[model samples]
Target: MNFIRRLRVPRLNDKGKWVVCVTGGVLTCGFAYALEHTADASDFVVHPFQLPWSHGGLIDSLDMASVRRGYEVYKQVCAACHSMQYIRYRHFVNNFMSEDEAKAEAAESEVDFIDDKGVPAKRPGLLNDFLPSPYPNKKAAEAANNGAEPPDLSLMGWARDDGDNYVFHLLTGYGFDPPEGVLCEEGKAYNPYFPNGSVLAMPQQLFDEGIEYKDGTPATMSQQAKDVVTYLRWACEQWHDKRKQYAIKVYFGNFQFRTPPSFFLTQIMKKWSDFSFFLNYTLLPHGIQSVKKDYLF
Candidate 1:
């Protein structure tokens, strides 16, 4: 009762009421106009959502099996257009495949170079040779793909926010048709998860049983996407597994460091910790076939 008495409500006389009515009308109109012109984020384009780390972390290393499988997928499917020019055949040696195996893999692809005679010649790829692109040049790539050059995959994993999730979703997000009022161009395919746009030149690539896995892992679309994303991430940051291992050692090892504790230890430890944290993003518990996959549609 005392609190209510402390509040003084102003009374509106005839003139005051008229002024109030006008003010309210103006405010209502302004609010309506603002709302009418306001941009809607969710309504415009769907953003990439983070996916949980399914593999073990902390003690466990990067899933080499997944990386190998992803390499296979890239070789058989994505290599048709996409390139990994920054990667070398030797990168596979001691990382996933054996030296002989890497050499054999390198031997499969041919590399072009100029010989001492100054004549342009081609030879079988070597361990030191960089990975090949499908096109001889950007112009050729563009011409082949209707002026859209297929991007190199070497650095794509680190190029965007939530890149792993982005790539994964993009590979799997092609099933949905464009929503009403959305005009997808004839050549471009509709993918809601595409950044800032609903349509992309890249069409649906991964499909069920598209490639057989040597390890007997079923080649579901989601699984292929997951594997390829893993490989891409490894290509982007080859030190990921080693970085985690060293961090664990620095954190729990007996040796004492002279440098400040938090700066080095804390920062490195965060990347490959017990789980969740990475190159610095907290992954939520979104499973393989979770709400995120269907959220945009």
Candidate 2:
């Protein structure tokens, strides 16, 4: 026979629970407010990217056409100022072009490398050569660009606070009339999305039909921004899609073996309560009966 105990659970009154919740909420809000206000304040509005493969999508793969177009746009416009120091011609060969095609593409750009004679010489780029920098060195680049060297675009997609959208906004957020009372510093252009008081060295880069898209896509301002942003995103993490796939597979494969803590706690409570009731009611009752019988005898 199974014996059940009438277990009494102490419950918090509605008012007490409400006070606890309110106190917790107030503390949380205080902490969050402190954290938020601790940083410098600026009117930096982040824009979202118009992408189909963002966050959650069935085919979270890169748009290769956009990538290719972005590369062309970078070559024609951004390459003059910025250098992608991390990227090599082989990256294109492996992902976008064949070896012969990559070689042809590289051959168009002259790169300095050490020849077999151990002397640095200028030669047509090979399939393995890094992208040629627009300036010979940093000092020259800075001198040319008014003491500010243009940053590399290789990781621009991930390096900024807004990730990929930062690049997109910077490319397109130019030409807006500066707000009254806000003076752009000397030699700096006004861009509201720029974190430091809307002052930027780079002027508006993309314009409508600025460059001819070899793929025949219309080169609107927004179109160029999106394509270049896509390429930059790819540059930041070329294997992001593959990494996501691996993560999904690994998570699901091990999900079934994991036990939820709440369920485990409930099971332990049930077993403990059953054993407590049995010890108190069943064992104590028999012991009391035996003591009474022995006294009577």
Candidate 3:
């Protein structure tokens, strides 16, 4: 009780020491936050939306139906510009489609091949063929699209932060006119969702009813965005579902191996106790300093 009273009334000389400690702590925190906030953070604007496959950071794996729809979206719309250079038709066969269906899909396209006579010839795409690029080479691709090289999208979903969301927004967020003072070039389209608001070379891709959905799904802007993003996600990581399953098993296995039932019960309690003591030791002085600042100020 006496000690509590004494603490409530610190010696007058100690007040300056308390103020110095509190001021130093606040200045340290402020400096840390300032250091963390950087110019690149401006480019990280993400428009929030919900999707059927992901909810609140819990990804339910890519739905096969959505993947199929997204593939169609890519074929009909995105394939004209971007290429899925790393993907093969065989992936579809292994994951989503039957062998016959994959063959049929591949057959619709053609690939360049060397004939027995050592002459170049084009042949119908095969199950093992890479998804063909829109142009034969970088210069040709650039020439067709006003000197801009559309990125290969096989790994696009994994390439950027929130890549799924970024693709969706960039695809669908184009029709609006630029805000005042924003100048869109003559050929380029304005998309606020794009990192450069007015200078993106790729024009708007998704429009209402732009492509007929074979599955009878409505081809609205948002629907197309969802389907195409789903496809890109799958294209980028075909093993996403398998990876999750593997991860789950690995997590449990590690836990079991690390913690024999009898030892875990004892260790976890001690771990928590140590953690709590460390946390209080680290925070309690700062917390007291904060209260002193509030009261004294």
Q: For residues 36-80, could you state the per-residue lDDT of candidate 2 as single tens digits?
A: 865434544334555443433644777778888999899999999
What's model 1's TM-score? 0.71
> How does model 3 score by TM-score?
0.71
What is each predicted model's overall lDDT from 0 to 1?
A: 0.83, 0.80, 0.80
How much is 69 displaced in model 1, in angstroms?
0.4
> Which lDDT tens digits does candidate 3 get at residues 185-274?
778887777764445888888889998988899999889888888888888777788788788889989898877975978899998888
- Give me the overall lDDT of model 2: 0.80
lDDT-wise, the better of 1 and 2 is 1
Q: Show where candidate 3 strays beyond 4 Å.
A: 1-59, 256-297
Instruction: Give the TM-score of each candidate.
Output: 0.71, 0.71, 0.71
Q: Which candidate comes out best when scored by lDDT?
A: 1
